[model samples]
Target: MTADRSVLPRQCRGQAGMPHEAPHTAPPCCAGPDRENHSGKDSTGSDAGSDAEGQRNQAVFTPDGLTARAMGISCAAACNPACSDPELRRLLTASGISAWQTDRLREVLALAAEASPYYRQALQGVDPASISARGGLHRLPLLHADVLRRAPLSLLCTSQDDVARVVTLDTSGTSGRPKRLFFSEEDLNATVEFFSWGMLSVGHPGDTVLAVLPGERPASVGRLLGTALENAGMRSVAGNMGQGAPALARLAHTEKAAVIVGSASHVRHLALAWQQAGYDPGSIHTVLLCWDSVPPAVAGLIRRIFGCRVLVHWGMTETGLGGALGCGHQGLHLREADLLAEVIDPVTGTPLPDGQEGELVITTLRRRTMPLIRYRTGDLARLLAGACPCGSPLRRISPGRGRTGEGITLPDGGSLYPADLDNILLPLAGLHDFEACWQPWAGTPLQITLYPAPAAGTDRTLRQQAEKALADSPLPAALTRHGGTMFHVARTAPQAGFGKRRIRVIPQGTPPLNSGESYHEQLP
Candidate 1:
């Protein structure tokens, strides 16, 4: 049965002052014979600016057409800023082109098979023309991360000279080889275009944005984001989190930044520091959390401390830094024109119904340099059951997301995840960071070390508060009642790095050590 979207509950709406104008859309990168490109680059040499940018802006919205910006949609309403324009309903639903007729998909597949060594071998006997008739992207074999680790160069569909940048990431285990991803100029430009469109949700022209992410490298996320914001007619300052929270707060105050973007942990730390120093929260309008699973406690604390709208972004380097962007409501809106997404059973590799939890898989529709086909993301999430309250035609991904292989078995036959502790501990006042160790054979099965914020220092009362918070949670409370737990307050400053947190599980037979000895285990 078709659900009634107009009457759907307004979940996270009510934020005022959000603009209703459509963002700039890039010139058609996937233009076909049927779809002609009429929009010329703006004075900034990027996407055609918003409608208010004057007469030279030629990009027009056609329900049947798609562009690199996914044809930016403007949701017109004061209460629900996340909804797309009612016109998008036709573009994404009934009037959209079929998979067989999409020129972008055909172009990507042809390029991969023709120039990429890996795709040439992997797609043997698999005709691109038969894809639509056989089944859509689901019929293709799943691409595992191991393939990238084993042979990254073979996946390139462009000339070596055309490669603009290569990002290398170390694998989890010690002996594993690092995975490398290459991007060409056009590929990177597409990412910038998407970023420009996504940033419009939080910022406006002439607004200053502070990006608290790594910007030292030329191809770093911060640099690309800065370029995107500038092209969108905003002032952007890309700063590093390693400069510490206090320093960033000072910069934000000096610049009067309207928006701040960083990972959940880093932004949480900054918010705590900003509050401790008595900084006025009115200067900042929004905080964008990305790069990892967002904890509810952390998000709540940030919202309370900053008194600003908090939005979560779910994407990875493999996704070209732009996958699903938060709709400022309940879920994330997929970049439908640039990528194809699927949720499949993790155990059986079968496609799952909407609202069912499964692994996320992506197929790049416009990427030309290194096109990833049906790639497994190892993230456990689900497509939202019904249409969004905002009436957007784009598919939505539920906010509850976690890494698939991150669960650790407990003594009571239950399982614990990093999110379990993050939900309980991260919001505690005066707390900055923490590390958990699980030693099942010892008297204290769960050990935690707390790092206080610089302003708070290492106080004994903070330890008590941490214990009480954990004691209130069901799983940790049960474990403490039966197996006992340990809490230690560290005097050293908290690590400023924004990597994901995990609990270290010690082997059963290992000898118990004194709590005084440092028990910091390296995280993967």
Candidate 2:
């Protein structure tokens, strides 16, 4: 039986039935993507001239108890000679990226030394206090993934009673043993606050948001997203993607959803499903995407098909929840207040300058349950050179290339990224989405499969064109030699699990590949 849905409801209004372009009164209280910036210093926020500089620095949004600037965490004008301006120093020391994190980093190091056996042994002879300032994080050794897997419980700083959630991270064929992370109530609350800020970017009070991620499970992304929406005066519904698209459309129509959030491809799946079910995509004003890198073509197709704006969000289960979200101005804006970010040479682990592509490493500013110090995120990205157009002094980062572990490593040790494949395939006519896997073993050759977009037709000619194009590329030519190093490439309809987040690379048929297969090379 075919399902029918109506996009039109009695009210097509914005949140709480307020006018879409309505303005909030001056004196903004929170840091959200959607809120207007009125620093009250001058027309130009950051570029304000001399006399207004101090007053302009006070333009930072103070969300009640979250910022030290709000509470007046003080330091003498001469305490640190780095900055000539007192307000600038206060901003950096209080609410800026280095602000709270400088102090929090010290606390975590002390906690790791006191409680976690893994970090204690890892930090053997080092003094936690000496390495607690800005740039002090790099002095510490990298906490390898193996240590987290082998000594999982040894990473916990809090007792079981204080731990509210324990999430096992999927190595996704990158690591031998998966990492299990524990979080306290306060840690979870931090995620909720982050989400509140992210939601504020696209939504408003009393608007309904339909999420396709996990909703029913406790501490799940969807559930926490719902809680965050509630905190910001919005309603949330988790469609779960389990009951199929028609059911999801029904829920959205019933709730009058103004926004939809989902994993990378799942947003496309839901939007397309709603379209096919005869609902107007215009019913939803914005789309929020996370969990993977989106090709430029996919983003365009989604925008055209859905008649809406697309927001890219970056985060990990390890960082608690979302740490950064795109403000649609330039790159993704980092949550400098809660987390400090660094880009480092993947192989050498030395820090990279802004605008230089490298591996992203993070240090949680205020987490207590399981504090990760200078934890390697394995994602390849570069820091944006300047402030976001949205005018928040918080730093922004490039939407990353795929994970270092997700790259396809050849026998000779050169690598190809899934994003490289997306770049080649997404532009082709009749192409949808594709997944490539290599089963390199003693007898078997590497195997790759390309899936056509839904309703993109199963004609072999279109498939052959894609294959030939890929074969002509440098990546395939290197691997598809006549004798020693051999590989296989084929095309098929979308695989078994077509909708949700798809693993770009799989190894040995079952379990994910070990860390050796992952590549962290920076692209030009």
Clashes of each: 0, 4
When summed lDDT is taken over every stretch of 10 residues in candidate 2, the lowest stretch is 1-10
What does candidate 2's lDDT look like per residue over 1-524, in tens digits?
11111111112112112233254432222223232221121111122123333333332221211333322444321121111233433344323445456666777788887888788887777776676445566778876666667777887787878888778775544547778888887777767766754575566666788887865568888778877776555778877655655577778877889888876466665666576667776777677777667766556555666666677788887788777776554577676656778888988999889999889988776777778777888888888775443445567778565776667666777776766666566555455445555545524244334445445555465567776766766666666652222222234333323132323433344543232222111100
Tens digits of per-residue lDDT for model 1, 160-219 = 887888998764432678888998877787777667556755565558899988777786
How many residue-pair clashes does candidate 2 contain? 4
Best by lDDT: 1
Off by over 4 Å in 1: 1-103, 132-136, 172-174, 399-401, 411-413, 477-484, 508-517, 521-524
Using Cα atoms with residue i matched to residue i, what is each candidate's TM-score against the true structure? Answer: 0.80, 0.73
- In candidate 2, list every pair of residues with a backbone clash: 34-201, 173-512, 173-513, 432-453
Worst 10 residues of 1 by lDDT: 30-39
